[model samples]
Target: MKGGILLLRSIAVISSSVATIISTMLPLFLYVSTPNIELISIFILLIFSAFLIHGVLTHALNDYTDHLSGTDTNSPAILSGGSRVIQTEVFSVESLGRFGKWLSILLVMILLVFLMLGYYRLAVLLFVGLWAAVAYSVPPLRFSYRPFIGEWLCTFPSVLFLGFAGAWLALGSPPEWALQNAVINALICIAWVMVHHIPDLDADKNAVPPKRTSVVWAAEKFGLAWSRLPALTYYFLAFTCTAWLIPERFWAGAGVTIVTAVSALFIFKMNVADPVQVSSYEKIMLMLAILNAVWLGIFI
Candidate 1:
């Protein structure tokens, strides 16, 4: 049980979120003539902690909701469905419900503190971010199941809000460069998120009433390899944008995106070889993009 709680603590993959925040925020850390190092440091600390807290809350809520729906019972998607802790009986739904609610309250309190600090816009954005996270799996408005809108709801707010938050705190506003990077990164996130759902396509399709992830829906409408076109398109666009915006870092960014593109070409091969191995494919693209961002920051 203790191990399970510990697992839950790390299960939402908070490191990736932190990494994204840092990657997008990297420009602020490096450029900007007269920077507030101390304030930027403080913002990083608070925002980092906020992401951790928010991860816990959202993941717990997701586990509880998925458990109720019996969705995770047979799901094998490592990155999609909720943590299997509840499905494994590691935690009770009641306990998870209590934990999620308490964490939500805690997050709200932190937001209130941010508001009191006069960070009005940041505070409002954080509030909206939290709502989107919770709404991803919560009832009635289960954004996780809402198709493309649901995908946007889950990905953009967290990525953009945090990206903008980091820039806003450091630069007083998200610069055109940061905003461009934010949009590019957001597209990659949504793309990889769709990739993440591919491994679970069969599981989702076989479910009662069927859980239609983007890949599942795509494959239904288009053929298998063809269904992956949109994700591939997003990846290429991100690569082009990175190169166009910062041609100096094209090699660094291109190295990763090219590898990602090659991997995508073979996705059908991998998916067939190991139906559940898509997490590696999804995560690699994300990690490389993150690395590309960091590399871009360093050279600039």
Candidate 2:
């Protein structure tokens, strides 16, 4: 039973789940000056919970699908031995499938509650979110099998949807700042995904359903290596544009830009030398969260 619980927790991918929630909430924090604290708190909790459920369902479903497709068997040694839960018998295949279904259903129910509370936009977002989660791993529309599409899909929600949702929830409407910031966030998220893929190059190639980014990365390692540049450039450009256009908050924007630049440099160096290092990824992600929080504090 204890082992089962551990496996379930692993399926949840709690660190990634928390990062998603934080990314979503940070945008809201930045855009709203005096949002209703209690309501905002509840919404954050609900969204975080939804993401947790989504993560668990997505991982479990992916594991089940991989097993069926024999992708897990062909996975590289690094991924197969060190990372993959399903391949190692961390949980029974049947149990994982059951958990996946139940968790996905529970997430949908939670989204319905959001609709009941007049957060219709959030409800709609949840619908898309659920679809993305399932389609990424399942058959028929397994977008994850597609090269570039999978990476974009994986990162966009954290960057765009979460940021927009946060701003919308905070201000009760979408503003230019919200939209722009969301785009910047999305770029950053995409860059992060590209960097993370540097390590998974081998495993992704051998999988039954080959990943797009993996192929792309293999073909054009240099191009993929420089992928983070555009995102970093955008972050700085956005900050600069916002500062010049909205002079009152110029300092704040510039400050965030400086931090983003420094962080991007660190991330770029880490990716160049050791993409597979878990600590590097964690540190970069943590810095991103902090930078986002600071940006929100200044803007909202």
Best by lDDT: 1
Candidate 2 regions exceeding 4 Å error are 1-37, 66-83, 109-119, 214-248, 271-282
Cα-based TM-score, every candidate: 0.82, 0.70
Weakest 10 consecutive residues of candidate 2 by summed lDDT: 75-84
1-300 per-residue lDDT for model 2 (tens digits): 543444444422333334344444554554445656844784566556444544456556766776766555664433221235666677777877887788788878989899899879778667766876777777777776676666466546644665556556556776665565555555544444455444545455566666545334444565645545434444455455455424555554565566567666665566543444634653555456456544644563
Model 1 deviation from native, Cα RMSD in Å: 3.3
Model 2 sits at a Cα RMSD from the real structure of 4.8
